[model samples]
Target: MDSGGTPEQVLMGGSMLIGTVGAYLVLGAYLVQLQHYCLAGAEGKRKNRLTLYILVGVVTVCETLRVCFITFAAWRVLVLGIGQPVLRQSPAKTAPSLHILGSFIALFIQGFFAWRIWTHKFNKILGAIAVLIGLLTTTQLIVGVLTGVQLGRIGAIAEQAAVTAGRNGVFNQFINNNQNPGGLTPFAISVGILTSTVFVCDVLITIGMFSIFHVYRKRSMAPRAKSALRVLSINTLENGLITSLCAALTLILYYARVHPWIHMAS
Candidate 1:
């Protein structure tokens, strides 16, 4: 791949193309979902009106920004770098990074679930565990943002990062770690922590939901309410499992290094 994120790296063009198309596809689906939600008239006066608006606003903005950055990156590589000279350059070149934005949105959504876990009636032990899960999500956000900042210091011309070359350069130290625990760089350490938190947070949240179900099951609720809880528990399991699996797969593919494009596609 082009270390500078220039178009000279035709070898990884397929990866960038695939990623760009995937971004647009996902964006379309997201927008459609948002439209449906809006049409549902949930905006009609409600107790949590402000909270709902904020949730929608934050996700829309973050998702839009992610797609824009990725699109710009693809265009830069495929169009601008087409006939450009491939002079040897510093290994630590800068470019727009997407993971930080992803981290922010995931943290926001998962935080909502964490808040649900906290607010719902439960034992003190479970309440304490919910708080712990919330803290872990916050920690993930902080680490993700810090990693983006660190990467920006060493990568790109137009978007985010800038080049800083050397054996000890930020980029080299980052990519060199290879996920080794003993010699991990700050970036790798943060990534490892970030992915771990994602998996653990989702799992804990799902378990909390099940606990909530168990608590509600013992109550004398209406049949519809009980039915809703059952469906919710199933939904939670599916969502949590898919999220955790993706994070694990991405981490694995990243460390495998079989093909640079493979990890990017993940």
Candidate 2:
């Protein structure tokens, strides 16, 4: 199996690409909302303006942190020649923070979806299920973040050992010690759990929201309204499918040993 490049380069380079694309998408969504507001006028905008701004702000803040961490990690690796251990350690520390923030944003977005569903159907049970699932994912992410912090602490210890044993020796030691309690297996398991939970939450939210939209489309009598609803339903489903696929792939990569890169990229 040819892996192509050093994992450090693969991870950092992949993150750079993801972050750039994410920034564009985040800003683009905001821009689209703004453009719609401009064309549709204040009354149409008033209903959604606050929510759109909140989405933009939350995504912007999360992406800012992501870019900052990726930039520093890249500088440390490529420019400073910090080696594999530092690359692994540095990103491991920051990745969970990003994961937590991303999960928080997901919760907010999913909750909004639940609220919308409830607003349409007035179904407390459905909304409660959506919110409950969102909370479940958030809790899992919090635990995963804590586990990652512990992993980072372990990495820091390994880093100290590396300083004494020299750069190349670090990998050798990790390979030997990875079965120990404070080693690679635990971190991988945590990541797997985290990503899986995220995937589940996304899938549930997608189903819930799409179901609501489907009902709305079926119930509408006016052709124009039905057509507009169809467009929205398609967009919602498309976006959810993309996000759910990413989450699924991220878990697959975690188990496959791609680790931090795939998670960051997603």
Candidate 3:
């Protein structure tokens, strides 16, 4: 109904679809884990229980914010259809801030991976580097989101629904304005650093894990055990590659500026 460009359509629709599916998948996993823990009489050590609770809090907050974003977007569309000026005046006002939730989720998840790698007794230096990378990237992501939000609120960048009307030319013009208050250089630099560091961290973890698994497999005598380890290694490698690819793609789309919404959704 908005008659937006292909890129805008893809971004809006893709975000809706992903948000729905991702929420379900993530919450479903948490639900299953919670059920199992309950059935086991919550027998985990105190430290483990504390960690689980903290993680649950993080996931809950993230998912709740995501739902709010989806709801707000849908409401804007509906209001626009009904011929309201409110949406046009304050389009996507909350989205940039809300999007920071993704970075938080990534931080916690990546920190968990780092912890796992540390538990394996990998080189202490490498483990420290991985943690540092994760922290830096996450911090950069937050800064980028906040910067973009500041720009968006100041009219430096168009809102979510603004592009939906196929007004990309206006958006481009804003970006090109020499005296524009919100310069994109900082946001671009932040995203570049975050994505690069995240990719590097994931790669290091995957390689370290693979090498450890390979060593174990060679020493393993049981055929069944070796086969299981092979499967695990493959899964680990695939997950790492997928994460790296996503970060790379997000960075490309962002720097290229072909479709900023696409990168934001990523």
lDDT of each: 0.62, 0.60, 0.58
Q: Kindly provide the TM-score of model 3 when superposed on the true structure, using C-alpha atoms.
A: 0.65
Q: How many pairs of residues collide in model 1?
A: 10
Error of 1 at 237 (Å): 1.6
In candidate 3, stretches whose alpha carbon ends up further than 4 angstroms from where it belongs are 4-49, 74-82, 85-91, 141-145, 148-179, 182-186, 219-227, 263-266
Per-residue alpha-carbon lDDT of candidate 1 for residues 1-266, written as tens digits (9 for 90 to 100): 34555432544555667667867876886787688768755645566867877898998998888888777666655665555422111121323257678778878877887888888946886787688788998897888777666655444321221222322222323444532222334545666787788888877887888788767865837888788778767766776686677667656655564233322222
How many residue pairs clash in model 3?
0
- Better model by lDDT, 2 or 3? 2
Tell me, by TM-score, which candidate is best: 1
In model 2, how large is the Cα lDDT of residue 91? 38
- lDDT at residue 11 of model 1 (Cα atoms): 40
lDDT of 2 by residue, 107-225 (tens): 66655665666566546666676667757656775765675465466556656665564443343233223543344455555666677777887787777777787888898999998
> How does model 3 fare in lDDT?
0.58
Model 1 ranges with Cα > 4 A deviation: 1-46, 85-97, 156-186, 217-220, 259-266
The TM-score values for the models, in the order shown, are 0.73, 0.71, 0.65
Residue-level lDDT for 136 in candidate 2: 67
Clashing pairs in 1: 93-155, 94-155, 94-156, 94-161, 95-156, 154-162, 155-161, 155-162, 156-161, 156-162
